[model samples]
Target chain A: MLAFKLAFKNIFGAGYRTILNIAVLSFAFVTIIFYNGVIDGWNQQARRDTIEWEIGQGQLWHPSYDPLDYFSYQDAHGPIPEGMREEVSAGRLTPILIAQASAFPQGRMQGVLLKGIPPGQAILKIPTHELEAQDGQVPALIGKRMAQSIKMKEDDRLLLRWRDKNGAFDALEVTIAGVFDCNVPTIDGGQVWLPLAQLQEMLGMPGEATLLVAGEGFTPTGNTGWAFKDHDYLLADLNKIIQSKKGGSGVIYGLLLIIALLAIFDTQVLAIFRRQKEIGTYIALGMTRWQVVGIFTVEGAAYSILAILLGALYGGPLLWYLGKVGWAMPSGSQDMGISIAEKIYPVYGAGLIITTVLLVVVSATIVSFLPARKIARLNPTDALKGKIQ
Target chain B: MESIIQIKGLTKQFPVGAGKFTALRDISLEFHRGEFTGFVGPSGSGKTTLLNIIGSLDTPTEGEVTVLGRSIAHLTHKQSAQLRNQHLGFIFQTYNLFPVYTVYENVEFALLLQRLPTAERRKAVLDALEWVGLTDKMDSKPAQLSGGEGQRVAIARAMVKRPAILLADEPTANLDSKNSHHILQTMKQLNEELQTTFLFATHDEKVMGYLRRIISLEDGRVVKDEEIIMDKITEG
Candidate 1:
């Protein structure tokens, strides 16, 4: 307690020097929390967008299906399993058929994935119900990115050509029914959606699908020929991407902490060098050498405490405002081949805040203690005379 | 009178290059309670070294020196500190007052080490300030005081704990004659009223004139030990 009292007095006596150190340390504190909060916000937003726009609660793939291998789409489809038929009719499961195709828009050839879903399917947010055929033309839906690339709009006609299961090529004209906006790039780019029955009939493969999406809270109990993949398995790639981003942010955190701690360490070294007589005075007043050391150490650690308070004074409102209005990404960020929303709302979790505070405080204390240990070796006689020993 | 300090064959040495330099040679001395004694010598004559040894700030290299009742040679660092904290007080030539602390805080520091209660600590601090005639400057920081006022504050800090012994090394070295005489008179009054043993290391004639006894050192050896009769001293 005595050490604390003396330490506070000494720090305040330092005046502007104390404020400068606190300002630097508070910058580090606020920067660390802000960066981590932004990354976490992106992680949360990306995961949510991917789940809502592409993957549902989970997915079930045909035994031969490999989403990464385009050739696997040829043999990936089979008749819907009898057990899952009831679930599919009940809207608990939605089957989707995918076929690699090419589209000619304005006499330009572009490769695309033609996905077929029930017109009334509610399992995903693709606006598939807009795919209702009209005026003897098959209606199709495309994401905003795809529509922009193809230079087409609603009611525009395009020639789509694909090979049937029997190795026969067929061509058809489809009218663009809708162009939906989505944040998940994988689901938005280079994809077109058509009515399930129309695509199945065109491909000469009726009552067949390449994959089944499980709706929310629908658990698959019995095993069919198709394999069931849980949420973790389906979202592994997205998780890995988020983890890598966090690792990159960790480096920033380290750099900020090192700079702040270096300043504190330098201040402590100088204080010990300059306050020798004061140290001797304390010893002469009945304090042990260790007590003197404690006073200096506490003096250094007190800088961080002051910084925390200063940071809260200014950073609190700034962070709260950022969390509410969100940070807007660059216009072309959605083309980065990852799931990123237009604006990211930072989420400052209590755990992240507490962990950051502890890390910085503990680090500052250890740095402070390092130089203070020299006090234990100082000779009180020499110190009293302001002599270096 | 109680024998508060006893030194026998005491010596202190410092390493100089590859060789050892002796600061105090084999010497014996004794001091009793309430005695105003000074070790008078020129610079590097070991007067300060002897006072430091008696104050328990440094251990004798080759002798058993006892302050109060604890052997300086055998006292651990903590025990030495405790002895100094509880029974010994020190004043320095530079008046090493904590620059940031006010006069009151500086005086209160010693009692704080003793963990005195609030009311008791307050009374002791105020009394010590009154003794040094610094009651009006209780809230003034060390840098804001003159040389004499600073020395007086230092004196208050040392006397605040009411220790049995006070070691002062060139306490008036930086003060003018007027301040020096004033500081000495205040200390003399404290010695008479409280019976606190006053020990000093100085070559200043002003300080020597006020001493009841003088131990003169030359080249690390005590060359003269004399008791002064008050009637023979001229008032200056």
Candidate 2:
């Protein structure tokens, strides 16, 4: 306990050197916390956006359905079972028909997915009310990305070609009824939404859909020829993406830790090297070599106390403002191939702050102790003479 | 009088360049309680080496050194430190005061190591400071003190715990002639009043004038050991 008091006194006694070390360390503390908070916030926002836009509570897929195999579009679909009809009408289940098609807009051919959703249902976030056919023309809703790629505005017309369920080619003019903005690239890039019945009739598959998306409070009680997909199973691909992203972030975390620790290590080394006379003085004044080591270690570790206080003094307002206003993601975030929202509001949990404090304090103590242990080997008499060796 | 320190066939060696260089050779010495003695010598004459051996800061390299009846040669590092903490004090040529600590804290540090209670420790520190005439400078750090004042603070620090013996190595080397005499007088007064043994390693003539006994060393061997009687000891 007395060693702690002496150590505290010594740290403050160091004057400007103590201030410089604490300032550098506090910046590191705030920065590490901020980066971790931002990454977690991004992960949460992506998950929420995915749930609202693409996948609902869960999904049910036909036994043969494989989204990666475009050729399976023909075999992956089956007629909606009798059991799902009532639930589908009541909006607890949403049926989507998927087919491969190509559009020639102003002499340019682009492959796209033709997704058929019910016009009156509100199970998803898409604006499906505009999917009603206008004067026998197939009304289609395209994303802003698709609209930019094809340079097609609302009320414009494009020719779409597709193969029917009976191995027949059919083509029709699809009129762009709306161009919508969304963060989920799956729904917004090279994909068009049209009415379910019109698409089923056009493809000669009158009562079939590729998969069924379950809505909130939906319970699957065994439907024939359909396998129930739980939330974890449906979001497995997204989880894998997020996990890899976390792995990448670990590299960055490691770099930040090394930079901070290096600064601390350098300061400790210099202090020990410069203060041999002090070490000798302490020994002469009745301190054991180990006690001298402890004084130095505590002096080094004491930086964390000031670092944390300063971090909170400045970081509290900055983090609170960030939590409210959120971080604005860069313009081309969607091109990075992860579901990042336009803006992500960082969430700083109590667990994050506590863990960071423990990590920094422990690390500082260890780093401090290692260098000060060198004092144990010093010759006290020679050290008293200010001998370097 | 009980012997406070005993040395038998004591020798210290330093490994220089290729072989060992002997600093002290086959020296036998004993010091009684309440003695004011000076080991007088020029540089490299083994005076400081003898003091370090008796203070438990260095090993004998050849023979036994017993301080306050404990064999320093067989003492573990911790035991050696305990002996020094409880029974020995040291004043250095450079004062060696902690630059960051005020005079009061520096003096209080000795009592602190003994785990004395706060009130007693305060009294002890204030008493030590008063003895050195630095009561008004209790809050002043070492940097603010002159050479004489700094040495006085060091004397207060060394004597605060009232150790049985004090080891001083060239304690007056950095002080001017006037300050040197002043410190010597203070130490002589403390030695008489407290009945504390004082051992010095120095060649300063002013320090030699205040000594009741002088052991002269030359080339790693004691050449003269004598007691001097004078009608009047110089107050300086």
| Best candidate (score: lDDT) | 1
Q: Which residue pairs in candidate 2 have backbone atoms (N, alpha carbon, C) closer than 3 angstroms, thus clashing? A: none
Candidate 1 residue lDDT tens string, A1-389: 98889998999899888898889999999989999999999999988888887888888899999989999999999999999999899998899999999999989999988899999889888888798777888999988889999999998999999999999888998999999999988776888899999989989889999999989767888879899988799889989988998899889878988999998899999888898888887887778899999998888788888898999999999999999999999999888888998999999999989998888788888999999999888888878887855
Off by over 4 Å in 2: A130-138, A221-223, B230-236
Q: What DockQ class does candidate 2 belong to?
A: medium
* Full-model lDDT for every candidate: 0.89, 0.86
RMSD per candidate (Å) reads 1.7, 2.3
For model 2, how does the per-residue alpha-carbon lDDT over B136-182 read when each residue is reduced to its tens digit? 99999999999999999999999999999999999999999999988
In Å, candidate 1's interface RMSD is 0.9
Evaluate residue B37 in candidate 1 and report its C-alpha lDDT on the 0 to 100 scale: 93
Residue A74's lDDT within candidate 1 is 92
Best by TM-score: 1
Error of 2 at A333 (Å): 1.5
Error of 1 at A194 (Å): 1.9
For candidate 2 chain B, the 10 contiguous residues with the lowest summed lDDT are B227-236
lDDT of 2 at A196: 94
Query: Per candidate, chain B TM-score?
Result: 0.98, 0.97
